[model samples]
Target: MEYSKHNIFSKVKDSDEYFLLNPLSMQADILNSVEAQRYKDKRIENQQEYFKKGYLVDPKAEEKLFKSKYLDFIDERDSDEIQLFFTPWYTCNFDCSYCFQDEYTNPDEKVSDAVMDAFFAYIDTQFADRKKYITIFGGEPFLNTPDRRASIQKIIDGANQRNLDIAAVTNGYQLEEFIDILKGARVREIQVTLDGTHEVHDKRRMLKGGKGSFDKITKGIDLLLKEKIPVNLRMVVDKDNIDNLLNLARFAIEKGWTKSPFFKTALGRNYELHHCQTNNKRLFSRIEMYQEIYDLVKTNPEILEFHKPAFSISKFIFENGELPSPLFDSCSGTKTEWAFDYTGKIYSCTATVGNVGDELGTFYPKVDLKQDLIEEWEERDVLSIPECASCNVKLACGGGCAAVAKSRTGKIQSADCRPIKELLELGIGLYSKHEI
Candidate 1:
């Protein structure tokens, strides 16, 4: 018997106690110095318990277990539920400074009735065996014009006919105009971005003509909450807006937005995707972003009332009170999720949705697929990646984002590894102080 390769051990700050996390089993054990030493020495072992906990393992047996778990994770990808992201247009009203979609040409191409017909036809025939739902994507799905609103209604109507639930990622500029349509449809949740306080948010998320959008967006959020429609408030964080995060949190609390059960919030790292946005210099790395949030939470605990920064490890611990289940894959690309742009071009995931060369195939007019490329993406997971297979924290990291990997290494087969040790250390400290 030997120490498991998957075990991650770290000392709790300013204390003799330590945490032993087994990502495979999603278990965490807090141990004192003496206890940790005893376990390491195999002096107080019930061999069976030690083996079961993955504190000690036989080499061959460990390999078998890893293989079994990896296979199970891959097999579970045969999910019955299918999430489809449909882009009605690519022309958003807000011209946020860090908008990654800006890398693609903002074509004025609209979703015509013919396109919608082809889309539904493709779904019926190709995805017939699966349950389906639709997520209306941008350029601003709710653009506030009568013609745009009518187009949205048509998309909603199509989904409603199939008893499909609908969700949308919009700028929330014209949410008021579509309230009636939203109320009628099987609305799931609407995701709207609010970078920071009015000053910060308006500057970052502004109208195309450089007008402030704070008032309009807040009004739209108010309407959604009043109607009890679920709203996920997203904040795109970067160096420019990092300082204002706390102020935004305070604002949300003051407005009682945080207290609403129908509301949820998340922070998106403003980073490069297919190509670097103009604000690349101001972008934060994954670990850097989490560190910023950690510092903010430390200074002002009230921010936790609005939303907790659950960087991967912290999220698992907070949600499950355990380490994290071993992840065979990190993303849903080419698997349970697929993205369909306004032109009927299909891609693996949202990150690659509007990318120039990433289209997996076309779904409209007739069903066409680049099976080789699709299979390549579909087969990607931690177990399948050379670097990920040998990493100690592969379970926690899950090989990082496929999009990031592709962009950085020019290959989807690599891992976009985070600073796992630092992240885990931070997570341990953060969660130790806060219960959730």
Candidate 2:
């Protein structure tokens, strides 16, 4: 048993390969390859500059701050409840193979009003008199076609009437079509996905007609820009798209997407669905992909200023110091969030909805879905988990994305851990050297 000096984990690595917590194991030679050294050095130097500019924080330090701040804010005895996610529809226009919601019945089917009422009622009670952040996500939220859109509008209106913060994650294909509704609805935040460049994005995401959706999606983004809606363009990286990620980043920078109100990149969610497995033939190990991207950004110093919030969070901790709260290395859903399916069934997050045994509980007469979930989340305190406690980077990585872990392993406790761990280390290394 290798105990980490950080006391974050009891045993850093286990006998099972999947349980191994070696950050180095996930690194790709391409990352440290001699040809990449020049870039890596440049990245370090640039990151230091970012630090001077107050652009980053040290991960460990951030963890300490996060925990303390959160603890001070949360009443230990009051049953701290902070976040929730609601997915109105599971039907999406683009079927990327890895969708975890596939297990749910097609979005075409309407969930009984009884379920919606029960679920919302639960939310109303648990968050009584208190404002909370709410996220709207879906297979393709825009697919509600006719009445669905109106229903979604109603949900938003209802939330707004209660004075809640709102956000949504969408595919963006229907963005242009929904501009009026979105503006009128006053959605606080909107996230749209772009997997890679046109070629890479189209390969993984396509329309029902088998046509690529890149063009249409970008057009929607342009529309958002025209509408001045706060937007975040989400890019998911898989093996097929890893090589081009920096290029994608550069593209985002060129379009001024970085400086724009919305822009972020997430590694591909772990798991292979039918179409999402397009990179199967050329799959790079998770560690390889993570390191390559980290290295790419490290060497190309100019891109650091445009780092997405997720990366910025990592850099913040690395450069400034850790916060007290546990970092959310895992899926955000597991710790502070969850996804509610159309039928009112609740899962840990959007990516793990359809997985077996992943349900925390369903909307039912006794469950009190809202209160139950908040209670369940507190019971499963992420910092106390065995796996997270034993890892040195535990504070930095935040126990890995819960959604990714559940999607790949069918259990919330066991998702692919290599990439996230490596990402934290890379971010820390970059931040430590930053001048600020």
Candidate 3:
């Protein structure tokens, strides 16, 4: 018998307790330092408890059974909802300092009715039997122009005709003008960004002439809520603006935005995806940012109303009383998500949507696919990654994002490994006290 390679240890916050987690085996236990060391060293005098929780296993038979179960998990997994992203055009009013689309986009490009017709035709036939939704994506979806609003109306109408719901990810500077157009439509939600309070946010997300956009965005949020449309408020945080998040939360509370049932929130970390930016130094790694959130939430519990970071597995276990099944691939890419553009191009996911040379196929004028490339993305998982095979956290991290892996090393099979062990450490420390 030997210690399971899947065992993970983390110390409880402000206590002499430790957490032992085995993600693949779906086992968790609390122990003292000596017990943790004994398990880590595989020096188990009492074999019953060790075997009961999958802490130790027979290297030949049980390990083989576990690997077989993992394969079964991969083959038997289910995805009921498919998300199709439509980037009508990559044009926006906000000249965000970190805008990834500005450098490569055509200033005057716009999708016509012909493109929309072909998109609907293709989507209708291809996904007719599947449950799916349309997501309006772009440089910014709601740009507040007569022509743009007309185009957006057509897109919404097309989806509505097919009984599909829609969601828009926009900057919100011009959302007020489009509220009536979206009224009574099948809108899942309209997502808007607020980096920080007005002063801090305007510095990073501003108009082309360097005008602040905070006032307009917040007013738009109010209008959206007034019209009973759901708004997903997102805050993109980095070293430069993380400190102002609490202030923004207080402002939201004062505005009564937090009291509305139509309002929702998410937090996004500003990290390098396609390429490193000038402000890349301000970025926090996945674990680093969560640690910051952990520290922040400890002092200011009110932040939970604004944004709640999923403290990885610990929080899930704390609430659900169990662990999730193994994740063989975290990148939904071609599996459950697909990105389409008016230019008739197709990409794997949101991260690689507008990127040049990432096109997997064309869906208009002619229908063709680079099946081999799409297959490469579809087959990506921990089993295909060389490093993940030996790593204990592979099931938890799911080998990271394929788009980022390809960008960093030009190989999808190469891993952009997440510090899952480190994240679980922080997670246990942050959420153990709230154990269910």
Where in model 2 is the C-alpha error above 4 Å? 1-4, 7-81, 97-107, 111-115, 262-286, 305-314, 318-335, 364-377, 382-384, 387-390, 401-425, 428-436
lDDT tens digits by residue: candidate 2, 1-436: 1212232111112111111122211111112333234333444334553333222345565456546744643453244344567766667777764454555566466444565666677778855754466777776777537777776776677677767767778988888777877777656678888887888888777887678998988888778876777777766665566667667777778877667665444555345532244346655565565566667666676546544324423545444444334343434454456667666677766556645555677765456445564454444434545575555554445555545554565454553454444454554455544443
lDDT on C-alpha atoms for all candidate structures? 0.83, 0.57, 0.83
Model 3 C-alpha lDDT per residue in residues 1-436, reported as the tens digit of each score: 7777777776776678888888867888888889867766767567888777787777776578668877777555444578899998988878888776766754667888888898898888877877889999998888777888888999999988888999989999888888888885788899999999989999999998999999999999999999889999999888888888789889998899999999988888887876667778899888778888878877887787776667666667777889987677788888888999879888988898878999999887777889999999988888888888899887788888898899899998889888877777777776765433
lDDT of 3: 0.83
Model 2 C-alpha lDDT versus the unseen true structure: 0.57
Clashing pairs in 1: none
Model 1 ranges off by over 4 Å? 13-16, 36-49
Clashes of 3: 0
Query: Local error of candidate 2 at 409, Å?
Result: 7.1
Task: Please list the residue runs of candidate 3 whose C-alpha ends up more than 4 Å from where it truly belongs after superposition.
Answer: 60-78, 434-436
Q: How many backbone clashes does candidate 1 have?
A: 0
Give the per-residue lDDT of model 1 (tens digit) for 36-110. Answer: 788767685466876778867787888898888877776666754778999988898888887878867888778
TM-score of each model, paired residue for residue: 0.95, 0.71, 0.94
lDDT of 3 at 261: 95
